[model samples]
Target chain A: SQQGEEDPQALSIQEGENATMNCSYKTSINNLQWYRQNSGRGLVHLILIRSNEREKHSGRLRVTLDTSKKSSSLLITASRAADTASYFCAVGTSYGKLTFGQGTILTVHP
Target chain B: GAGVSQSPSNKVTEKGKDVELRCDPISGHTALYWYRQSLGQGLEFLIYFQGNSAPDKSGLPSDRFSAERTGGSVSTLTIQRTQQEDSAVYLCASSQGFGGAEKLFFGSGTQLSVL
Candidate 1:
């Protein structure tokens, strides 16, 4: 069973627009992380929001965690063509391993 | 410092043959992980190691799949009698420590195809 599941399998937007993706999980998590993957490549770590943190930000990426709902959201501000990629959310447990979601594909038009 | 590195960027093998994939983690990292991603799909957890000890082998699919880390640095994943369904990209990652919310460094991954 997958611990995390992202909504909206794909998203497309124009340049300068903001893109948002949501992830929901089943069990308790120590942290939730977002990752970006270019086509046929390894994933790049984006932002990690700890269980105790309600929100966090890095550059244009903002993450919010809602432990009460077991959900998280990733918002990319000013989307760019370079931001076109697959975004995945992973849940990290106290045990130290992470379980990833199916991912949401985001395409930013140049 | 170099990031995690994986070997044989690409591999194509016969269905009945055995294949080996190797990973060299960043120096000083204590945790290593393996994952598989199929075309148009998300990553599936395979195995994880914490300084040569795997407290979790539950992610491994079957007896035909196995992995080992040596000297707490390099690790290898082996698949025996591969099947066509085994075709996918194998990714490796490493982190500075175990557990919590530390960011992980990843390798480009090996594209494996079992014909």
Candidate 2:
């Protein structure tokens, strides 16, 4: 079963705009990580935010986690055409398994 | 290899046929994971191996699916009597340690098509 659920199943924006994706999970987690998949192939690790920490950033990607609400969000600033891909949020539990959510497809038009 | 490597970037097999997918994780990495992603669907956890410890096979969907990691390095996932529902991209990933808090490096994955 999937642990996380991402909102806004699809998003379309113009270049230089910002895109935001949200995810909600069912249970407590040790950490949460975001990944990007291009062409429905391999997924690349984007950023990871521990349960103890509220936010993390990598390049233009920003991730925020809220344990109380059991949700997280990913924000891509100044989106580019290269940013078009499927974004997924995975929840890492105590058992060492990372369960992914139904990803949000973001399309950045140039 | 600098990153995880999977064999036969694409495979097409007939129903009831058996297929083996191989994954070679990065050198020195101890954790390996298998996941299945259907078209337009979230990834489904298949299995996980960490060092010499017993593998976690709770995520496997059926007895037809089995996997093994040899020498704590290369891993293979075998599916017997393939079904159309089994057609999906099988992804292999490896991490330096256990995955609860570590990032995983992924391979391009094998696109399996069962007819």
Candidate 3:
């Protein structure tokens, strides 16, 4: 069974707009991470938010974790054409290892 | 420093054949992982190795899939008697330590096509 699942399988937005992706998971977690993958390529780590953290920010990426709800959200501010890619949310258990969600495809139009 | 590297960026093999995929992690990394990504599917964990400890083989989908890490630096994933369902991109990642807190560095991955 998948631990995490993202909503809105595909999304399209104009440049300078904001994009939001949500992930919900079952079971407790130690941390949740977001990763980006280009077409037919490996995933690149984006940001990680620990369970103890309510929110985190990196550049234009903002992540929020709600342990009480077992959910997380990734918000990309001022989306650019370069931000077009697949975004995935992964849950990290206390013991280690990650369980990933299906992912959301974001297309930023110029 | 070089990033995690995978060999044979792409492979096309016949069903029932065996294929070996290799991964060389960044120097000094003590943990390695293998994952499979199918079209429209999320990354699936296959196996994990950390230092001299035993590998976590729980994620392997079936007996036909196996992986091993040598000298805690490089790792290899082998699939025997492959089936059409085995066609997917095999990705390898390495981290400085075990568990999810450590940032993982990924390789471009080997796209496997089974005919």
- For all candidates in order, state the fraction of native interface contacts they contain: 0.69, 0.82, 0.64
* Candidate 3 residue B59 C-alpha distance from true site, Å: 1.7
Task: List, residue by residue over A1-110, the lDDT tens digit for candidate 2.
Answer: 43789999999999999999999998889899999999999999999899999999889989999999999999999999999999999999877888889899999999
- Which is the better candidate, 2 or 3, if ranked by DockQ? 2
The CA lDDT at B61 in model 1 is 87
Predictions in order: lDDT: 0.91, 0.93, 0.90
TM-score of chain A considered alone, across all candidate predictions: 0.97, 0.97, 0.96
Give i-RMS (Å) per prediction.
1.2, 0.8, 1.2
Name the Cα RMSD for model 3. 1.1
| Highest TM-score model number | 2
Query: Which model, 1 or 3, shows the larger TM-score?
Result: 1
Question: Model 1, residue A46: displacement in angstroms?
Answer: 0.5
So what's the TM-score on candidate 2? Answer: 0.98
Model 2, B4-108: lDDT tens digits are: 999989999999999999999999988899999999998888999989989999889999999999999999999999999999999999988786678889999
